[model samples]
Target: MARIAVIGAGMGAMAAAARLAVAGHRVVVYERGETYGGAVRRFERDGFSFDTGPGLLTLPAVYRDLFVKTGKQPLEECVDLVQVDPSSRHVFPDGTEVALPNASRAGVVQALEAALGAGVGDRWGDFLVRAREAWDRTRRPLLEEPLWTDWQVLAEREPYPAVPHKRLLRTRRAGTLAEIAAWELRDPRLTALLDSHALAYGLDPRDVPASAAVLPYMEHAFGTWYVRGGIRELARAVYERCVARRVEFVFGAEVTRIVEKDGWAAGLELADGTVTEADHVVAGVDPGRLRGLTKHALDEDGDVFPDASAPSPGRFTVLLALRGAREAEAAHRTVVHTPDRGAELNWVSGEGPGPVRPTVTVLRPDDPALRPDEEHESVVLTATARPKGDWAADGSSKPFVEMMVHEAGAAIPGLRERILWQETRTPGHNGDETGAFCGGMPAPSLAGGKGYFLRPSNSTRLPGLYRVGGWSHPGGGLPHAGMSGALVAGLIVEGPGFRGSQ
Candidate 1:
C-alpha cells in the first residue's frame, strides 16, 4: 500500500483521504486549523446558529457518490438532505417577485410567465433548453473527469448554443452572458434574473462566456438542497466518514513546505520543524499558497496555471438574530436584485467604491436548530463584494451591511425591527478560515473565455503530487470540490490512465 500524505482537512482533502484509505492506502491528513471543514464553519450566539459558508447545496449526487464509494452507509443516512421547494424567491428591482420551484422546469416557466408577463416564461424556458445543451456537452470533461490534456479544446469552443441575431448588417450570436440576456431575454427583469445566477457565484456576467448557462441548468436539473442543521453538518458527515475509513488526521499541524526528493513530491514539512515522508502527496490548498510551499515549479510550460492577476471576488455576510418567529410561508432563500446592475458590476470588478445598493441574498431556514426558541429566528444576509474591502476597520463594512438589511426588508416582514443581534463576516474572515487569498471564493471552471477560466490540472509537474479542491481542476463550489476529490483518488488508485468515474 502506498503511503499518502494530504495537506489540509478541507472537504476535498478528506474526501480523497477516505477513498484512498478504503483502497488500502495509509493516508494522513495535516490541517493547519484546529478543526476540519475549511470554509464550512458555523457561528453560534444566544442559542442561535449560522452557516458562514455556502447556504445551499446543488448537485448533491457528487456527495452521494462519495459516500457510496467509501462505505456502505449512503449520504442520506448521515445527514438530512431536504429539497428546497421554490428553490429561490427573487425580488427584482422593479418590485416583481417570483418564487421558482425546485427542479421543475414547467413550474418555473409557468411561475415566471405569471409574474414576469405573458411571454417571459417561454423565453426563460427556451433559454433553459439551450442551457441544457451546454451542460450535456461539457459535464463529462469539465466535472466528472480530470481536466483533459488538450483542455484548450474545451476552452476555445463555446458550448452554449447562441441564437443568431442580425444587428447593423452583421449576423452575430451572443458570445457573453450579457449578450444572451440582451438579445434572447430582451427584458430588463430577465436580464437581472440571469445576472443574479452569475453574481451568486461571484462571477461577472458581463464577461463570463456564454457557456456559463450551465450554472443555472445544473441547479434546475438536480434541484437545490439544504442540510437539516446547516451546511456545517455536511462537513461533519464527510469528516466522520474519513475517520471511519481509518484516515489519520493531525489538526493544527500547519504544513510549511511540500518536501521534494529526486524530483518527486516526497512528503510534507510541518511548521514545527518536523517532516513526514509519504509515497504520494495531495495538496488541497489555494494555488497562490501552494506555489509558496514548493521550490519546484508546480505547473510546467503550457499548463493552465491559476490566474493571479485578477483577484477572485469575496462575500460580505451579516448574521441576524431576530426577535420574531420566521413567517410560515417564507422562502428558505430570497435574492433581492440590485437596482443598478452596471454599478454593482463595476464595484465587483474593483473599478469603483461599490454600489449604494448591492444584490443581496437572505437565507432563513425553518429549522429550530438555528433559533433559540419558537419565538425567535436566525437569518443570514450575504452580498458579493471586493476581496480586498477593508472590512477589518471599525464600521468599514457597516454601510454595506446596513444596505443588505435594507434590501432584505423587501423580502422579510418587519425586517429592520426584528433584529436582536448581528454578527458580520468579511472576506478577511474567509481568508482566516480557508487560507484562500483575500478569502475570495473561486468560481467553477468554465469551458470558454479562450481557456482563461480553467483551473490548473490535478497532476502537477511534480510526480506523485496532485491537487484536489475548489482551487484546482473542476474549480470551486461544493459539488466541484467533491468531484475534484474523486478525480484525484481515481488518478492515484488507477494510475495516470484514470479517466474519471465511468
Candidate 2:
C-alpha cells in the first residue's frame, strides 16, 4: 500500500482519499479552509444556511459506485436524495416557459412543444438521442476509466459511426456555443436558451463547444436531484466516508508546497511549516496551482500538469438565505433571458479588477433544513465571467459588499425583501481558500468536446500523484468528481503488478 497525502479535502480530495484508504493506502488529506467541501461548501448566518456552491446534484449512481467500490454504502450515511422533478424551467426572452423533464423524454418534449412550438419537440428528441449515444459511448471508456494515456480512453469512447472517432474531430481552432446552437435549432429564442445552458459551468454559449449539446440531454435523461439536507451536506458525507475508511484529515492546515526528494514526490509541507512524508501525493486542488505547491525537482524536460488544453470558465456567486420561498410559476431551476431588454452587462461597467463583468447563476436551495423559522428558503443567484478580484476591492472594502448586494436584489425579482441573509463570493475567494483554482473555466470548457473521449485523463505528471474534483478528471461538478475518484483508485490498484485490467 502506498503512503499517500491528499492535498485537499474538498469533494475531489476527499473522494480520492477515501478510495485510496479503502484500497489499503495510508492516506491523509490537508485542507486550508475552516470548512471543507471546496466548491460544494455551505455557510450559515442569522439562523440561515446557504450552500455557497454546487447547489444541486445529479447522477447519484456515480457516487454510490464510489462508496460501494470502496466497500461501503453511500445512501446509508450521507443523504436520502429526492429526484428534483421538472428538472428545471427555461424562461425565454419572449416570456415563454419550458419545463424540462424531471427524467422523462415525453414530458419534456411536450413542454417544449407547448412553449417553443410543434417541430421543437422533434428536434429536441433527436438532439437528446445523439447526446445519449455520446453518454453511452463515452461514460465508461472516457469518464469511468483511468487516464493511463490521454487518447487511449478517448479512442475507446469515440469508436463511432459503428467505428473510429476520426470523423468527430473538428479541425476548427476554436468552437463556440453560438455556432453549435445555430447548427441544431432555428429559432433565435430556442438557440439562445440552448447557448445559455453553457452558463451551467460559467461558459458563454458563444464561446463553448457544440458538443456540449449533451448537457440538457443528460439532465433530462438521468434527472436533476436534491439531497435531503443542504447541498453542503454532500461534502460532509464524503468526508465522513473518508474517516470511516481510515483516511486522516488535517483540516484548516493549508498546504504551502509539495516537497520532492530525488525528483520524486516526497511529501507535503503545510503553511505552518509542518512536513509529512508520503510515497504518493494527490493534489485534489487545481492543476494550474500544482506547480506552485510542489517543491520543484528540476526536470530535464519542464513538463508539468500545465493547465488543461482549455481551463473551465469561472464566475461570481451570491447565496441568499431567504425568509420564505418565492412562489415561482416555474420549476426550481430557471434560466431567464432578455429579448433585447435592458440590463446587458450594464450593472458592471468600469468595475472589477480585471475591468470585467460577471454573469449570474441563480439556484434555489432544495434543502428543507436551511432556515430556522417556518418556511425556510434559499436562493442561489449566479451568472458567469466576472472580474475575480474586484469584489469588495480585494475583498476588504466595505462599500463593495453593500454595492454588490444591492445590485443582486435589483437584478432579480423579489430578491432583496425575501433575503434574510446574504453573502457574495468571487472566484478569487474560492481560489485563495482552495489554492487559487476553479476560477477560470468550468470542466466543460476543458472537458466538453466533439471528442470528449479525448478529455484529460486522471493521471498527474508527478509520480504517485492523482487528481479529482471540479478541476480534474471527469471534470467539475459533483457527479463527475465522484467518478474521477473511483476511476483513479481503480487505476492505482491496477499498478505495475496488477492482478486485473481496469
Candidate 3:
C-alpha cells in the first residue's frame, strides 16, 4: 500500500482521494482554504447559496461511474441530479432567441437555425460528427491509462513521445474556432457566439485550433446537466465517498516543500513545519501552485513541471441572490447569452493602468430551484478574459463591482428589480483563489500557442511523485479532472499498467 497525500481539496483533489482510498492507499489531502471544493464551491451569502465554479454539469455519467466503482450509490449523497429539458437559451445580436432542448440533436439544430438563420444547422451537424469521432476514439485509452511518471523528467529527456488517444493533437488541429465559425455563418453575430471559446481556452478564437470546436458539438450531443442542489454537491458527494474509504484530509494545510530522497519522492514539508513521509505523492493542486510551493523538489533536468503562465483571453463575473424573482421560463439549463455587454475597458494593476475588454456571459437562476415561489432566485454571470489592468485595486472595489453589476443589469432586463444579494469576481481574484496562474478555468487556450505536451502530466519532477487535476493531460473540466484522479490511482495500483492493460 502506498501512503499518498493530495495537495488540494478541490473537485480534482476530492476525486483523487476517493479513488486512492478505494485502492487501499493511505491518502491525505491538504487544502489551504477553509472549505473544500476550491473553485466549484458554494457559500451562504445572506441566507442564499451560489455556485462559484462551473455552474452546471454535462456528461454526468462521468461522475456516476466514479462512485459506482467505489461501491457507493450516487443518489445517497447530497443533491439529486435530474436531466434538463431544453438544455439552454442561446441569443443572438439580432434579438432572435432559441431554446436548445436536452438530448435532442435535431431540436438543438432547429433552434440554432431559427436563431442564427438557415444553413447554420448543417454546419453544426458537421462539427457534431467530428466531435463524435473524437470522443469515441479518445475515451478508452487515455481515460484508462495510468500516467504515473514525472512529466518534467520526460520533457528533460525529450517530452515522452507517446500520443494517448489515436487522434493526433498536432495533425488533427485545424482552423481557429472563430475562423471555423466564420466559414459557416454569415453575420459575425453567429460567429461571435461560436467564437466564445476564447475564454474557455484562455485563447483568442482566431488563434485557437478548430479541433476545439468539438466542445459545442459535445454539448449538443451529450446535453447539459446539473445536480439537484448545486454543482458543488458533487464535490461533497465525492468527499463522502472518500470518507467512507478513510482517506485522510489535511484541510487548511499547505505543502511548502517536497522532500526528495535520492531521486524518488520521499515525502513533503507542510507550511507549519511538520514532515510527513509517504511512499507516493499525487499532486492535485494546479501545477503552477505545486511548482511554486515545492521549489526544492525539482530535478536537475527539470522534467515534470508546469508550463509558464499565460493570460486567458477573457474574464469578468457577477453573482446575485434574487429576493424578488421571476419564474424565468425563458431560461432552462444553460443561458448562453443575454443583452448586457462591456466591451474591453481599461485594466489598471499595481504598475497603474492598462487596457482590456472582455465578453460577458450571464446564467439566469434556474427557475425550478428551492424558491418557494417564482420571486426568489440565484444568478451568476461570467465573461471572457480581460487584462488585469482593467479593474482598479482588486475586483473588490465598490466602483468596479458596481460597474460589473450595472453592465449585467443592462444585459438582462429586470436584473435590478430583485437583488437580494450580490458579488463580483475578477481574473486577478481567480488567480488568487485558486493557483490558476492564467485566470482561465482549468485548461489553457490552445490558440495561444502553448505546446500540447507543455501541460504537465501526472508525473512529478522527482521520481515516485505524480500530478493530477485541471493542469494535467486530458485537460480541465469536471470529468477530465476526475479521470486524472483515476489515472493517478491506477498508476499507483500497478506501475503504469502492464502491456495488455493498454
Candidate 4:
C-alpha cells in the first residue's frame, strides 16, 4: 500500500483520506488549524451557536455514497438529515413573494403562477426543462468524472441547449445567462430569480455561460437539506468516519513545503521542520497555497491552475442571537432580492463599490440545538463579496449588514430589536481561518466559455502530486468538494486510467 500524505483536514481532503485508507493505503492528514473542518466551522457563545459556513446541503447523495463506501452506517445514521420544506422563499423587488416547494416541479410552478401571473410559471417551467438538458449533458464530465486531458473540448463546447429564438430575420440562441433571462423569461422578477442562482456562487450572470442554468436545476432536482445541529455536525461525522477507518490526523501541523525527488513529489516538510515521506501527495487547499508549498510553477494549460489575478468571491456573514423562538410556519431559508440587480452584480464582481441595497440570504433553522432553549433563536445573514478590499477598515460591510437586516425585516418582525448580540465574519477572517487565498470561496465547476467553469485538474505536472478540494477539479460547494475527494482517491488507488466513481 502506498503511503499517502494529504494537506489540510478540509472536507475534500478528509474524504480522500478516508477512501484511500479503506483501499488499504496508509493516509495521514495535516491541518494548520486545530479543527478538522475547513470553512465548515461553528461559533458558540453563551449557549448560542451558529454555522459560519454553508447552511444547507444539496445533493446529499454525494456524502451518502462516501459513508456507504467507507463505513457500515449510512449518512443518515451518522447525522440527522432533514429535508427543508418550501425549499426557499423569495422576496422580489416588486413586492411579489413565492415559496417554492422542495424537489417538486409541479408545486414550484403552481407557487410561481399564484404569485407572479398566468404565463410566468410556464415560462420558468420551460426554462427548467432546458436546464435539465444542460445538467444531463454535463453532469458526467463536470461532476462524475475527472477533468479530461483535452479539456479544451469542454471549454469550446457549450452544454446548455439554448432555446431557438427568432429575432426578425435571424434565429439566435442565448450565449449568456442574461440573454436567456431577457429573451426567454421576459419578466424582471423572473430575471432576478434566474440571476440570483449565479450571483450566489459569485459568478456574474451577465457574462456567465447559459450552462449556469444547471445551478438552479441542481437545487430544484436534489432538494435542500439541513443537519440536526448545524452543518458543522456533518463535518464532525466525516472526521469521525476517517478516524474509524484508521486515517491519522495531526492538527496545528502546518505544512511548509512539498518535497520533490527527481521531479516527483517525495514528501511534505512541516512548519516544525519535520519531514514526512510519502509515496504520493494530495493537496486540498487553494491553488495559491498549493503553489507556495511546492515552490514550482504549474503547467500553462490553465486547466489545473486557474488565473491567480481573478480571485474567487468570498462570503460576508452576520450571525445574530435573538430573544424569541422561531415561528413554526416560517420557511427555513429566505432570499431577499435586491431592487437593482445591475448594481449588486457590479459590486460583487469587483466592478463597483456595491449598492446600498444588496441581495441577502437569511437562514433561520428551527433546530433547538443552536440556541439555549426553545425560547431563543439563532439567525444567519450572508451576502457575496469580492476577496479584496478592507471590509473592516472602511466600515463598508457595516452598512451592508444594516441593509441586509432591514431587508430581512420582511422575514423576521422586529428583527433589530430582537437581537441579543451580533457577530460579523469577513473575507479576511475566512482567509485566516481556512487558509483560502484572500479568503475567497470557490464556486462549483461549470461548462461553457472554453472551460471557464473548469477548475484545476486533479493531476499535476509532477508525477505523484494530486489536488482534491473546492479549488480543484469539480470545484466548490459541500457536495462538489466531496466529489473532488472521490475523484482524487479514484485516480490514486485505481491509477490514472480510473475514469470516475461508478
Candidate 5:
C-alpha cells in the first residue's frame, strides 16, 4: 500500500483520506489548525449556534456517494439531511417579493409570474430549459471526469446553446450572461434574479459566460438542503468517516515545506521541525498556500491558478441573535436585491468602493438547535466582498453589517429592535482562520477563456504531488470539494487512467 500525506483537514482532504484508507493506503492528514472542516465552522454563544461557512448544501448526492463508498451506512444515517421547501425568497429593490418553491419548476414559474406580472414566468421557464442544455453538455467533462490535458477544448467551447436573436436586421447569439438577461428576459426584475445567482459566488455576471446559466439550473434540479444542526455537522460526519477508515490526523501541524527527493514529493516538513515521509502528497489548500509550501514555480500552461492581477473574493457575514421567536411564515432563506446593480458589480470587481447598498442574503433556519429557546432566534446575513483591503478593520464590516440588517428588515419585521447581539465575520477573519490568501473563497469552475473554467489538475509536475479541494479541479462549493476528493483518490489508487468516479 502506498503511503499518502494530505495537507489540510478540510472536507476535501478528509474525503480523500477516507477513500484512500478504504483502498488500503496508509493515509496521514496534517492540518495547521486544531479542528477539521476548514471553513465549515460553527459559532455558539448563550446556547445559540450559527454556521460561519456555507449555510446550505446543494447536490447532496455527492456526499451520499462518499459515505456509501466508504462504509455501509449512507449519508442520511450519519446526518439529518432535510430538503428546504420554497428554496428561497427574493425581495426585489422595488418591494416585489416572491418565494420560490424548492425543486419545483412549475411552482417557481407561477410564483414569479404572480409577483413580477404576467409573461415573466414563461420567459424564466424558457431560460431554465436552455440552462438544462448547458448542464448536460458540460456536466461530464467538468464534474464527472478529470480536467482534460486539452482542456482548451472545454474552455474555447461555450456549452450554453444560445437562442438566435434578430435585432436591426442582424442575427446574433448571446455570449455573456448580461446579454441573455437583457435580450431574452427583457425585465429588470428578471435581470436581477439572474445576476443574483452569479453575484452570490462573487462572479460579475456581466462578464461571466452564458454557460453560467447552469448555476441556477443545478439548484433547481437537485434542490437545496440543510443539515440538522448546521453545515458543521456535515464536516463532523466526514471527519468521523476518515477516522473510521483508519486515517491518522495530526492537528496543529503546520506544513512549512514539501520535501522533494529525486524530483518527486517525498514528504512534508512542519513548522515545529518535524518531517513525515510519504509516497504521495495530496494538497487541499488554496493554490497560493500550495505554492508557498513547495517553493516551486508553476508552469504557466500546466496549472490552473487564479489570475494574479485580480484578487479573489470572500464572504462578509453578520450573525444575529434576536430576542423574538422566528415567525411561522418566515422563509428559510431570503435574498434582498440591491437597488443599483451596476454600482455593486463595479465595487466588487475592484472598480470603486462597493455600493452603499449591496445585495444581501439572509438565512434564518427554523430548527430549534440554533436558538436558545422558542423565544429566541438566530439569523445570518451574508454578502460577497473582496478578500483584501481594510474589510477586516474594526469599523470596516460594521457599516456593511448595518446596511445588510437594514435591507434584511424587509424580510424580518422589526429587525433592528429585535436584536439581542450581533457578530461579524470578515474576509480577513476567514484568512486568519482558514489560511486562505486574503481570505478569498474560490468560485466553481465555468466554461470559457481557454479553459479558465478549469482548476489546477489533480496531478502536478512533481511526480508524487497532487491537489484536491475547492482550489483544485472542479473548483469550490461543498459538492465540488467532495467531488475533488473522489477524483484525487481515483487518480491515486486507479492511476492516470482513472477517468472519474462512476
Candidate 6:
C-alpha cells in the first residue's frame, strides 16, 4: 500500500483520502483547523443553527458517485437529501416575481412567460436549448474527466452556439454573458435573471463567456437540493465515510512545508517541526498557499496561474434568527435583484463603492432542525462582495448588513422586525474557515477564455505532488471539487496516463 499524505481536511482532501484508502493506500490527512469541512461550516447561537457556507447542493450525482466508489452505503443513505421545489423565486427590480420549478424546463418557461411577459419564456427556453448544447460539448472534459493537456482548445473554442444578430451592416454573435443578455434575451428582467446565476458563484456576468449559460442550465437540469439539517451534514457524512475507510486524520496539525526528496513530494512537515514521510502528497489548498508551502515550481509555462494577492470576490453573509415561524408556502430560496445593476456589479468587481441596494439571496429552509422551535425561523442572506482587508476591518460591514436586511425584506415579511438576533460574517470569517487566499471564493472553471479560466493540472511539475480542490483543474463548486479528488486519486493510483473516473 502506498503512503499518501493529504493536506487540509477540506471536502476535496477528504474525498481523495477516502478513495485512496479504499484503494488500499494508507492515507493520512493533515489539517490546521479543529474540525473538517473547510468552508462548509455551521454556526449556532441560542438554539438556532445556520449553515454558513453553500445553502444548496447542485449536481449531487458527484457525491453519489463518490459514495459508490468509496463505500457500500450510498449517499442517499447518509444524508436526507430533499429536492427544493420551485427551485428559486426571483424578485426583479420592476416588481415582477417568478418561482421557477425545480429541474423542469417546461415549468420554468411557463413561469417566466407568466411573470415577465407573453414571449419571454420562449426566449429563455431557446437560451436553454443552446446552453444544453454547451453543457453537452464541455461536460465530459470539464467535469467527468481530467483536464486535457491541450486545454487551450477549450479556451479557444466557444461551445455556446450563439444566435446571429444584425446591427445595421455588420452581423455579430454574442460572446460574453452580458452580450448574450443584451443581444438575445432582449429584456432587462431576463438579463438580471441570467446575471444572478453567475453572480451567485462569484463570477462576473459581464466578463464570463457566453458558455456560462451552463450555470442556470446546471440548476435546471440537476435540481437544487437541501439536506435536512444543513449542507454541513453532507460534509459530516463524507468525513465519517473517510473514517470508516480507515483514513487517518490529524486535526490541529498545520502542515508548514511539503518536504521533497529526490525532487519528489516525499511527505509533510507540520507546524510543530514533526515530519511524516509518504510516497505521495495531495495538496488541497489555494494556489497562493500551495506556492508558499514549497520552493519548487508547481506549474509549467502557459498553465493558469491565479494571483493570490489579486482582489477576488468574497461573500458577505447575514445569519438571521427570526422570531416568527416560516410561512408554509414560502419559497426556500429567493433572489432579490439589485436596484442598480451597474452599481452592484461595480462594487463586486472592486471598481466602485458598495451598492446601496445590493442583490441579496435569501434562504429560508423549512427544516426545523435549524430553529429553536416551530415558532422561530433561521434565515440566511448572502451577497457577492470584494474580499479586501479594509472592507472587513473598517466597520463598513454594518451598513452592508443593513442593506442586505432591507433587500431581504422583499422576500421575507417584516424582516427587520422579526429578527431576534443577527450575525454577520465577512471575507475575514471565510478566510479563517477555509484558509482561502483573502477569503475569496473561486468560481468554476469555464471554456473560451483563452484557457485563462482553466485551473492548473492535478499533477504538478513535482513528480509525486498533486492538487485537489476548487483552485485546481476543473475548478470550483461542490461537484467540481469532488471531481478533482477523483481525478487526483486516479492519477496517483493508475499512473500519469490515468484519464478520469469512468
Clashes of each: 0, 24, 26, 4, 0, 0
Candidate with better lDDT, 2 vs 4:
4
Write the number of the candidate with greater TM-score, choosing between 3 and 4: 4
lDDT, model 4: 0.89
TM-scores, all candidates, are: 0.98, 0.82, 0.83, 0.98, 0.97, 0.98
Model 2 residue 121 CA deviation (Å) reads 1.8
**Mind giving the per-residue lDDT tens digits that candidate 6 earns over 178-245?**
99898889999999999999988778888888889999999999999999999999999999999999
**Cα-based lDDT for every prediction:** 0.90, 0.62, 0.61, 0.89, 0.88, 0.89
Residue-level lDDT of model 4, residues 415-451, one tens digit each, is: 9889999999887788888888778888888888667
Give the poorly placed runs of model 6, Cα more than 4 Å off. Answer: 166-171
Question: Once model 1 is optimally superposed onto the true structure by TM-score, how far is the C-alpha of residue 302 displaced, in angstroms?
Answer: 3.4
Task: Estimate, for each residue in 271-318, the C-alpha lDDT of model 5 and write its tens digit.
Answer: 999988999999998787788888655544454446633568789889
lDDT of 4 at 142: 92
For candidate 2, write residues 42-135 as lDDT tens digits: 6777777776667777788777776776664756466767887767666664566576778998887788888889889777676677667666
lDDT of 4 at 284: 88
The C-alpha local distance difference test score for the whole of candidate 1 amounts to: 0.90
- Model 5: ten consecutive residues of lowest lDDT: 300-309
Q: Per-residue lDDT of 232-335 in model 3, one digit per residue for the tens?
A: 77888888788888987767787887777777777888889999998887777665567775545543353433344544433456777777654546464333
